[model samples]
Target: MKLARLGSPGQERPVVVLEDAVLDLSSLTPDIDGSFLAGGGIDAVRDAVASGSLPVLEGADSLRVGAPVARPSAVVCIGMNYAAHAAESGSLPPERPVIFFKPPNTVVGPDDAVTLPRGSTKTDWEVELGIVVGRRTSYLDGPEQAMEHVAGFVVADDLSERTFQLEISGGQWSKGKAAAGFTPTGPWLVTPDEVDHRALGLRSWVNGEPRQDSSSRDMVFDVETILWDLSQYMVLEPGDLVLTGTPEGVALSGRFRYLTDGDVVELEVDGLGRQRHAVHAYEAAAR
Candidate 1:
């Protein structure tokens, strides 16, 4: 089933996408916290939806669409997991996964406007497949078991600021990655049964021109392996998201071009749907 959190930023409501209109789900329950997904909330929600026993939704138009899951515990990322993206960034294949974190506050709805942060001249975009974990898992045996813990997937724009990322600092990538408004996720969170994870293509267009394009097939460490690898380090609890990494064609993968204010970025994954964000120049806050 296709699940989504819709409405304006702070006022989002739980919604399920029907063929045309969004099915309001928040009325069935209060905003589901991350712990719900970590526990057995995923199965419960699915069962509820399937049973057609949820409360009738009212105020569907009154509430806004928040991130489908409230604040996740963490937003873990795998850098250069796609070979072509790595080459474009002038890096060699890593012997292991390149992991990083984007704090949970970066989350925003799919169509939210993205700010080109103050002092950031090299704002960039990365369209990635986001995995939301449904169960707690640690020290996973391997990819097979890791796959079992996932709740669903969402499309994400891993908005970036290259100047802060590649320069000025000590090369700690997180400095550029975790800036507020850097991650825009969802139009919907599609269940595993609803998407062909392995076959879907990820494509991104900047100002209507295609920049990055590739398939999940190109991932160096596919979904299953990535989960297993991460579990060995920290427990992945429910509602925690992992950005599986972007395909080639990022501005950093230097056939390079950076974004300017007024540019529009559109990205999509097959079956998962799409997201569009317009970039804007930063204006300093009044003291």
Candidate 2:
């Protein structure tokens, strides 16, 4: 029962995370997206915070956390479901799932501030696991019906640029994955009955060092078989956000060196939290 989204960026507000405070889901739902997780809203915020009737989020510790879900309609991704990150990007492990799509306005905010685009030299960093769909999936019938259409789990990064994703704009990888903030997801969203999305634990770091530690149990294709192989084609609505890929130390196998201009990306997964950004240099925002 985590589900955050504090203030700033489109005026976020929804909240819930507790262990000692932060409740107010805006009088019970106004934006956790996908119409509040298809209207169940994590069982109505766990029975309104176990009947205490929610309403504590006063300061929420100086607000500004955003991206805990809100503004999604598709941000799917899944390339190289991690078989050593598909042999370190040279590629070879693909029996199915390798979809792509990252442009739901390139959602940002898990410690936002990453630009590095403008003839970018390769700017990489991945660390994923994000799911979040909760209803309206399509053509399921497998992978245990895609775990009843999931409704939680965050911690994503997927910020690539690798020469606009593989050299030019023809191979088609969301054209180097929709730039802007390049996805950088949430600080919480959690809920699939609490977590254990197939043995979580996917690490990453850049300026602080360690690149990508890896372990969604190596994931050759886990987590309800990538939502039953993306519901056979496409339709996952309800706050859509997939991701589920990155691992095997990034920097595109060159071993390291790509992101520049400050470099600081730190990501984590374990209990679905942790993300930090800091590479800037792209300005251009005066239209």
- Number of the predicted model whose TM-score against the real structure is largest: 1
Q: What is the lDDT of residue 72 in candidate 2?
A: 91
Clashing pairs in 1: 6-64, 6-65, 7-64, 7-65, 11-64, 12-64, 12-65, 12-66, 13-64, 38-238
For residues 91-171, what per-residue lDDT tens digits would candidate 2 score against the true structure? Answer: 888998889897887887889788877768888889899888889999888898787888888998989898888888797
**lDDT per residue (tens digit) for residues 1-287 in model 1:** 77777666666667676564555566555555566666666677777777876654556555544567777889999998888888888888788998889999898877777878788878889999999898888998878897789889989988888888779658678888877879988877888998889878999998899987799999998999999999999998888889999888878866767888788999999988888888777762211
Best by lDDT: 2
lDDT per model vs. reference: 0.81, 0.85
Name the lDDT value of residue 170 in candidate 1: 84
lDDT of 2: 0.85
Instruction: List per-candidate RMSD values in Å.
Output: 2.2, 14.6
Can you give the TM-score per candidate against the true fold? 0.92, 0.36
TM-score of 2: 0.36
